[model samples]
Target: MCRHVVPASASRKALLLQALLLISAGMVGTWCVQAITIETVNKASEVMCVRYWIPNEVGGGCNEVRMGNKWDIQVTDRWKAATVWATEGGCGGAHCNTGPPTGVTQFEITVDGGWSNDYYDISALAGFNLGLTVAPTNPTCASQICTSLSTCQGVVPGGPDRTKACKYGSASYVLTFIK
Candidate 1:
């Protein structure tokens, strides 16, 4: 009679490979859930208002985020899309300035699925009031920074070109105002 024994390391590697295969084949009974965080860092000279909304859903109204302050949005599971804006003044009442000249910084994100590719971008089409940067926690992903109207996209006379897509198990984004 002949018998064979497998090394512990080899056995562990085989188990890992089987798990990955199961996950990819959707045979595992668990769904992939990704945690996403969007943090805003205000580095401007004055107080700035930040607003975010998902399409077809009621959104958070403009709120003041003072210099050196931060605002955060946390989401779990899958989200279709969200748009965030950084503006100069408050909404309604006496402030109510949500347009250009002072400019408005726009950031958009879309997470299709935990196993699917996610997308993000910074647009100055609305205007370029403040310098903007989008930094992803995943170093394998790319970062986008637009410090001027000329260097940004979505503006008139130019086509959209600042979008990026990546697959991250857990995603974290930091939006910084560089002005």
Candidate 2:
């Protein structure tokens, strides 16, 4: 009679591989959720409606499958915004009427999942007019001093403060992600 026995290490490797396969197949295992908050300081006189979306992000706004231009760096999750001010408007959300405009405003959203090891951005675009500051907020962000996008974006995250410009309805801004 002939018999064969599998080594413990070999069995362990097989089990690990199976677990990986299951996770990749979306069959089992859990995903990590990350939260991102945006504080929109409305320095403008008009009560503004803030709108934003994370493109190519693994979330409801983007609703894209796990993907990356460089690799399978699936970093981010289902994102939904919670208005801390009187009105909410973004990606087809509604706006609530408010009597007066508050100089300071806030927006909060939770990303369902993400890779903490990687870096992502939370930014506004060419259309919005809300002064912005990221927190762990940089107090000296304005002083960083950049006359161009390349220079501004080149600054470390949270280093470029566009809140002053955005205060009075500046069309464009450069903001670092507030982790």
Q: List clash counts for every candidate, in order.
A: 0, 4
Residues 1-179, candidate 1: write the lDDT tens digits.
Answer: 12345566687779889779988998875555566778888887578777776664443444678888988877544456666767664443533232222257677777753456677788766666878888888888878877887786433325445467767544588888777
* RMSD to true structure for each model, in Å: 8.9, 15.2
Report, for every candidate in turn, its global Cα lDDT versus the true structure: 0.68, 0.31
Looking at model 2, report the run of 10 residues with the lowest lDDT sum: 63-72
RMSD of 1: 8.9
In model 2, where do residues sit more than 4 Å from their true spots?
1-30, 56-131, 137-179
TM-score attained by model 1: 0.67
**Number of the top TM-score candidate:** 1
lDDT of 2 by residue, 6-106 (tens): 56667787978977998899888445443333333433323333334433343222111111111111213343232222222221343222222343223
Judging by lDDT against the true structure, name the best candidate.
1
- Number of clashes found in candidate 1: 0
Report the lDDT of model 2 for residue 3.
31
Q: What does the lDDT read for residue 179 in candidate 1?
A: 73
